[model samples]
Target: MSDQLDIDYTRRNKKPRSLGDSERAKLEEFIEAIHYSARYSDNDFEYRHVQLPKQMLKVIPKEYFDGARGTLKLLWEEEWRALGITQSLGWEHYEVHEPEPHILLFKRPINYQPPTH
Candidate 1:
């Protein structure tokens, strides 16, 4: 007989973490809300084939364009506040008459410093 032994391998990094039932239910509720919003919009929004920052993309879900747009708006507001910038702007939606859809956020720069005599 050979001296080799068979070893069973398990994934070390894939362990499942348990969440409380209430927490799980809340998560499911949020997901369902997002899904419903994604499916029932009359705006006929389409997905745009544009590359966005990975960190920015993580705030919203990939399935719905509105989610991404909303997330971007919130992020931009937060950044502006943190950077002491003051200006109000809106997002623009456009289609290239090709494939996919995209939303662009435009902001006007403002001077936050006080006027001096």
Candidate 2:
């Protein structure tokens, strides 16, 4: 598949900017959910829908629906690497029994390694 990362995230020498508070909160929630799936499942991959809290939901409101929000936050490969994720796949790639039609299925082997900073 073609790389979907923004050109900005593609710059190796560029100093990645910090995510805003709201975005950070969302990512943290996502991290928890993703980690749960990864640790519990025996499969080589795991997936989770972004379930922002009601309070945080108000902040992002109509910007995105469930898994779509997760996809946006994880669109960049750099972000993927930071999360110890090997391959990230979306609805366009495959479907699962998720509540939302959209879902993010990620591939990380049982003996996976994260990228060194």
Candidate 3:
């Protein structure tokens, strides 16, 4: 169950950088499809195959998908779940925000240090 094959997505400033136009588009499409499926379908736990393209994967870093060992099927499932929760709620007037432009950005806490001479 090692996620040793996943990628890193963090930057030095501890902020996730914005995903490029193409990657963002693909990710949004992927998330939207899955979210809608989970929200509208009777089978919420159905297994689905969402293929993220190589170009989109290349823009993202290496750490985001490399953690958490468990029942999740894909490296990005956790993220998809987080984003799709609202859809599952069945809110009548709710406005589901599009996935963030930087969906692949990773934020890991780190101690800040100043350079010394």
Best by TM-score: 2
- Best of the two (1, 2) by lDDT: 2
Model 2 stretches astray by more than 4 angstroms: 1-18, 21-38, 46-50, 61-107
**Which window of 10 residues has the lowest lDDT sum in candidate 2?**
4-13
RMSD of each: 23.8, 8.7, 15.1
Best by lDDT: 2
What tens digits encode model 1's per-residue C-alpha lDDT throughout 12-115?
11222333455444334233222111111123222222223333334333322234323222223333222222233321112212221222222121222333
Candidate 3 wrongly placed segments (more than 4 Å): 1-45, 67-78, 81-117
Clashing pairs in 3: 7-62, 7-63, 8-61, 8-62, 8-63
| Per-residue lDDT of 86 in model 1 | 28
- Flag regions of model 1 displaced more than 4 Å: 1-51, 60-76, 79-104, 109-117
Listed per model in order, the count of residue pairs whose N, CA or C atoms clash below 3 Å is 2, 0, 5
Judged by whole-model lDDT over C-alpha atoms, candidate 3 comes out at 0.29
Q: At residue 67, what lDDT does model 2 achieve?
A: 47
Candidate 3 lDDT by residue in tens digits, 69-93? 2111122333433333232211221
Rank the candidate models, highest lDDT first. Answer: 2, 3, 1
